[model samples]
Target: MASTSARDDDGMKERLRQLGLRPTRQRVALAKLLASGGHRHLSAEDVYAEARRAGIQLAYTTVYNILHQFTAAGLLREVVVESGRTWFDTNTGPHLHVLDEESGHLQDVAIDPKALPLLNHLPLGDDVEIADVEVVVRVRRRNDSA
Candidate 1:
């Protein structure tokens, strides 16, 4: 049994259409994987591996390309946890993240809408304004054993 029903597939098509991307089979398959999970932060490699396991024979480069396309189209958010490690977050809205260093896990951290800090001081010309902000807090598990 496939996790995506016909209606769900149609919704996925609309999602891509809204992004001005063609709703190909590959895009729909990738979108289903990303959206089926509640809210996910997956690397391109993660998606490639999972797709292979799920019997989708797409190349790893294809996954990266699709992820980048989605990110550029505002369908996904890219969170850089470190120099080379990046996660494609399913949530595109403004939010914060708490990263577990030990397990390499990322989770969304709730932020109070009223508690957001105001950014001041401009280093750019008059035509510049801030549009979006991202904050990631890294954490580690506290050792319980003495």
Candidate 2:
């Protein structure tokens, strides 16, 4: 257990360094929670709640700021399902998501790129180039009686 804890700390430190973050006390604490247990999707409020549960004194605003910083640093990917709903994903690679409206839960959607609809005639400037596309499909479970 002790060795595992030490290894986790080392990994967190190295990850933060690569993202150009200073890895402060709060940052290290939050990063450990987010990056430790494999890939996860979390909102800023969820992150704050977890911090509080862990006895970490983190403010909501601070959580948002840290999440934004991590996203900007390329340590996390931001997924906005709607105007006010945003989630931070631990997986930085490009992928799709399926959001359950009733549960407000998001899960990864794995599909072949060839099956996806292509973006035709993008409205961009002459010097602009398309980089990536984010596809979010909202789904709800069908009721048995219906």
Candidate 3:
């Protein structure tokens, strides 16, 4: 498990380089924002907001471009919730995203691995491998006033 985690780190670094990103301080910070939090579900705007809050000097456009690069490189998963908000997920592995509609926060939900066979029944070709399965569950916060 430890070895696998180390490999993931190395792989991320390589991916940034391959994507033509300099892997500078800002890039590393951005990567950490995604990786360190276990799994994050954030839109480009969300990331930019957090970066600003964290005192990272990178512009919002820079964060957005970096996010697109990461998504293209398979380092992140892009999801659109029912609210029509685009969210970027730090967890690139197979998992489900649970969107908190009330708070606009997203969480990772566990799913049974056995169900993958059923997905194969779809029209997708044999070469297709599921990267991430986004299941945005919408709910409103309970009004305590009631």
Best by lDDT: 1
The Cα local distance difference test for each model comes to 0.86, 0.84, 0.74
Candidates 1 and 3 compared: the better one by lDDT is 1
- Over 1-146, each residue of candidate 2 has an lDDT whose tens digit, in order, gives 57987777788888899889998878888888887657789989889998898888988999899999999998888999999999999987767888999999899866643345575555678797666667888988788996
Query: What residue pairs clash in candidate 1, if any at all?
Result: none
- Model 2 worst lDDT window (10 residues): 112-121
Could you arrange the candidates by TM-score from highest to lowest? Answer: 1, 2, 3
Off by over 4 Å in 2: 1-4, 112-115, 120-129, 141-146
User: What tens digits encode model 1's per-residue C-alpha lDDT throughout 1-146?
Assistant: 65647879999899899999999999889988887787788988889998998888888988999999999999899999889999999998778899999899899976742356445444657787667778888999788996
TM values, all candidates: 0.81, 0.79, 0.66
Ten residues in sequence with the least summed lDDT for candidate 3:
112-121
lDDT for each residue of candidate 3 in 1-146, tens digit (9 for 90 to 100): 56965676576667678877667667777886787677777778778888888778898888998888788877788887755678887776666666676677777777744375666677867797765455666667789997
Candidate 1 has what TM-score? 0.81
**Best first by lDDT, ranked:** 1, 2, 3
